[model samples]
Target: MRILIAEDDPSIAAGVSASLRQGGHAVDAVTDGAKADAALRDTPYDLLILDLGLPNLDGADVLQRLRKRGTGLPVLVITAREGLRERVRVLDLGADDYLVKPFALAEFEARVRALLRRYTSQGAPELTIGRLRLDLPGHRAWIDDKPLELTAREFGLLEALAARPDRVTSRAQLVEALCSWDEELTDNGLDIAIYRLRRKLADSGTQVRTIRGLGYLLEEVKEGKESEA
Candidate 1:
């Protein structure tokens, strides 16, 4: 899962980022609401962990803006406020889940997983990029009529990439998706995974393209098997 952590406290932000990364999720941590809003606007994230205390803009304002723009991204609010009214307000403001400050890391991770499970089960129960299709609910992938067997890591990489098909995802993001914060994941490990996944995807005539210096994009092939524009 790709998550956005909108936290201002340096220590707390680091801890949250590390914990989420350790849980095999790609995380982008920001210290202010403006940066957090910008990140959400530019990227396709599976989940969001937002703190009420933020600079340049308040967390509530950020949530309000996102809703106004009709971005229904799943949001998990983490705040120090422990009042019943505050919790209700955040929930009513469009947050999918809430965690009080000094929350247990295990609880936080569990909530995140729960939200993702619910999100993936909705819609068509499948995500598609041209002929490539992933049955999110069934945890299956297909290239039109053929099933493509994929390892856990490969499947995770495919979901992260194929979720926002046509967009590029960085190597660092994929590394975080495959390995937790404490895991010693080398760049080569990601490369190897990509190489294996590419071979698996070859049958679809769709390829994972490397953009020289930036990252990778899962591109579908045209009738002649040419890469998508």
Candidate 2:
């Protein structure tokens, strides 16, 4: 999943970003309210970690504008404002979840997973098609109960493809999912990753079918249906 951490404190942002990256997520860390707002407007993030004490714009205003834009992007407000009423205000302001400072990274990661599942996975931790099972939070996949080893980028691509099944997911969307805002993913890298993924799923019931100029899709390999590049 791709996530944004809108935190001003450099150390805190680094800690949180490292944790999410270790969990196989692409994370973008921004230090100000204005930057956060700009990022929210441009990037498609799976989850947001926001701090209320942001400079230039403030977290509450950011949340308000986000909702006003009619985007259902899941927001997890991480702030030091510990009053119960404060929590209520943020929640009412459209924050999906809130966490106080001095919280455990483990708890934070868990909350992130919960919010991602709630908004993106329909509250399901896993996605299945035929004999393939993808543990979304764990970033592990299995075919016929055997593990499918995947790098972070590979898992990301597989997740994107799995979401639509037989429907095409555009190359641009796939690139956004696999690369961070700062990184560049060339066509060669995308093709290499897709090739390796195909080799991994060769014996499985499902396969990644490329749609030439359009994009790629994951679908069950039928007996007589030919797959195109």
Candidate 3:
């Protein structure tokens, strides 16, 4: 999962970023509403953690603008305000969830998981393709009920591919899924990740096939074919 944190507090932003990264998500932090809005406009993210006290354009205004622009991106508003009106205002302005300040890290993480599950999986916890299974919340994958060990990038690649099994996913789309604005992913970087993922899935009866001038596809191994080239 990719997330953008729009917070003016350096400490809170850093802490949230670390926690999200540790939880196997790519994260980017912006300290002001202007930058936050620009980041949202420029990148694709699974969620946004926004603070209402942001500078250079209040966070509520940012949310309003985003909604006006027809972006249905899931937003979790973090604010110190405890008033019902404030909460209702943000919710009415299109924030999907709200967290008051001084929240426990555990609770925050749980809320994040809940929101992601609601939006991304629509209540489904696992994705299955033949003998392969991806545990979305657990950040784990399995083949024939055996655990599959994979690096973070490789797991992300697999998740993207498994989301649409057998359909060709372009290299550009894969790169967007694997990288944030701060991280640069070249064609070679993507190729290396694909090669490593293919090797890891070699014995799982699942194959990641290159589509020549296109990108790649993930599919169950065909009968009589020992491997994918």
The C-alpha local distance difference test score for the whole of candidate 3 amounts to: 0.86
Q: 1-229 in candidate 3: lDDT tens per residue?
A: 8899999999999899889877767788899999999988898788999999988989999999999999878999999988999899999999999999999999889889888877775568887765788886567899888999988888888877876666899998898777766788888988898888888888777889888998889888877777674
Which sections of candidate 2 miss by over 4 Å? Answer: 224-229
Model 2 weakest 10-residue run by lDDT: 220-229
Judged by lDDT against the true structure, how good is candidate 2? 0.87
RMSD in angstroms, all models?
6.1, 1.9, 2.0
lDDT per residue (tens digit) for residues 1-229 in model 1: 6678899988888987887665546678888999988987887777889999899999998898888889878999999989999999999999999999898888887787677767874645677766778765345788897898887678878876776577898987777666533455688888888888888887576778888788998877767765422
Tell me which residue pairs clash in candidate 2: none
TM-score of 2: 0.92
- Residue pairs in steric clash, candidate 3? none
Which stretches in model 1 have alpha-carbon errors above 4 Å?
Answer: 121-155, 161-191, 198-229
Superposition error at 147 for model 2 (Å): 2.4
